[model samples]
Target: MQEKLTINYTNDLHSYFENWPKIAGYLKGNKQKLQDAGETCWLVDIGDHVDRSRPIAEAFRGKANISLLNEAGYDFATIGNNEGITLDYDDLYHLYDEAEFRVAVANLHTKTGKDPSWMEPSWVVETTGGVKVGMIGLTAPFPDFYNLIGWDVQDPMEILKQEIGPLRSSCDVVVLLSHLGIYADRDIAAAFPEIDVIIGGHTHHLLHEGEYVNQCLITTAGKQGFYMGEVEIIWDTEQECITGKHARAIPVADLEDDADTAEQVAVYSENAAKAMHRPAVVLPDPMPCGPYEDSRAMDLLTDYLRRWTKADLAFLNAGVLLDSFPAGAVSYMDIHRICPHPINPATVPLTGESLEQIVNAALQPDFVSFPLKGFGFRGKVIGKMIYSGLTFDITGTEAKPVAKNLKIHGRPLDPKKLYTTAMADTFTFGSLLPNIKQAEGKKYFMPEMLRDLLLEAFQEIEK
Candidate 1:
């Protein structure tokens, strides 16, 4: 007999729960309709559902996001970079503990456990008509961060090579829940033609109708909760094969919000607010912060970064601290509000020439004011470069300021001498700082974000 299995999926929500009510409403209502028609329907999430920038995700450590998934009736899911690298080992280990869905991530492995009980290498879903679909999940490989946090993130291609053949033999349809971005999805599609469908995220590319490559179908809903993805598989149960595949992203902005889900989200916000209300410190004096102007908070925070990493010199982007703190009891919530980026403190070993080059690049006005996105940055712009254990002289006035007379370790920069430069890992990716980005064997401090350091600074100041 012929059968149809409908897969409704979401990706890169990033804790943007505003449109979640409508998303949930669409899924819940559509799921009911498909079931009534004697077709199989399953709700799925592609990950990045729990972004720490959100109060609810931060307060509940992503348990709230999982709860929302449970309420939405999600059946299968995967992990994204945000879901995998943003949380500490303990948090990620327990993040899916209460999830109602099956978590299939083929490339994630933990050193702490023989296996993560909540994670499966692959999941086989059987439809009402007994059409078996094999699902494999993979996330972006960030070995440095993952290694620091005691996770052995395997290469996606290698894991797929090991898993696909076995999984394909056992199921009628093979699907991939991939958080490795669209480019990788295309590559994987070319490499693995047996994969009938690849649901992708991470780079946040929008796909209205879906992309067909190497006889494989690729789909994504982009970032936030703006759109939801749907896939229909026409299966021949008796022949045990897939006949057709179709996918599309449905916009949910104009849809009616599910009142119950909206109410629940509001409740989660209230509870998260209450949970984060506890005071971190009572400020004796207001600490100022901003992107363009000088910030004592940034200076102090840069000093703390050097201290935390024990690096010879340290620097940070002022924009990371979003707001100023008033002279009063500051709560953990306040800290998160002021600095919400999930960035890690990282150190890179570079020669004095490289350091000077990075510093010169960072000193450029256009460079500092660049509206950076991604790579763990959650701020408006790159902001002023704040430094610690380093000083420099300007060659000109505000007309066109030139950074010169750079000095560190109380001496002029040496071209050949290696220096450990401490900074946010945000600068280590893409083309932000070529010297830092190109540097090898860079050390990333995991789990501890810039906000955590800011919190620690305030707590210590209270002493």
Candidate 2:
């Protein structure tokens, strides 16, 4: 006799709630169909379901996302970087307290050598016919941020080496839920042929039809709940082995929205608006922000970053502030709307010469206007570089400024002297700023995002 099991999954939702109702509807409908056909089915999420860019997520610290997952009947899930490092350690530790599903991620642990009660290294499920399936979860190892947040994200390959053997021995088939992106998924599949299926996310690559690498099927749905992934495994009961496997990312855009889920989202949005309505500051005058020109708001934020981190200097992009701070009462929601990125403040030690190189690179038209998507930046462009604790003499035309005679504290910048400089965490990773990325002695401030610092800056100004 042949028995089949179906797994439906979503990844990289990133708190895009508009399409979630359709996703819930599709998953529920398919799950019911599989059960009616006498097949076992499971609903899973690969990760990145909670992104604070959405006001609902920011207000609830991801609890609302957990509620949505519960209502959708998710059976298993793992953590993406957004869920792992964006919230404080305490918040993440309790983020899944009320989750109805099992959370599995083998590599995440607290700094003091303890795992959260809700975390599982792997899970085993048996169908009605006694076909056993084993599953394990893994996330990206961003040590810099994770360590600062009081969590240690061990190497995924190392964790797999320890867990896969035990999982393979216990079940007829093994599955991997990976939040480690596409390149790592390919590598894991090639290295572990015993694993029958790998569901992936983080890079947001959509594989309309699953790809097979070394007899391991790899699949991923595109981000934001527009598509849902499905995998079917055919098990032969008489032979006690698997006979077939199929996978695809099914489109959910055309599905009808679940009325219950839509109502839940509305409630969450209303609650979030209320939570974020608290007054943050009272601005005496409107502080206008611009992408290319020097602005009071950008300068104030840059100066605040330098002072808050106690660095010798600070630099930030004008684009970080998305909107102007209107006169009168400023609310937390206003600040969140203007600076929604989860980027933290970081200080890196660089020599005067390296700083000069960074300034020169920032002055280039292409560098200033580059549209960056990742590295925790949720802005349209890099924009003009705003500086604090330093002055530059511009000798070129307005279109292309050439920075010269750089001075620090009323003296010429010494090329060989090392200085600690502060900036947004975005520049510390990507090719946007090579000198800062390669700089030594980097110290990151966590549990407080740039928006938090902006609030403090405003408070100081009000006082």
How do all models score by TM-score?
0.97, 0.97
lDDT of 1: 0.89
Q: Over the stretch 333-451, how does candidate 1's per-residue lDDT look in tens digits?
A: 99999899889999999998888787777778788789998988889999999899888887766645777877886888777988888999988899988888888879988889999
List model 2 lDDT by residue over 203-261, tens digit each.
99999988999899999998988898999999888998889989998888788999999
Cα error, residue 164 of model 1, in Å, equals 0.6
| lDDT values for all models | 0.89, 0.91
Model 2 spans > 4 angstroms off: 396-400
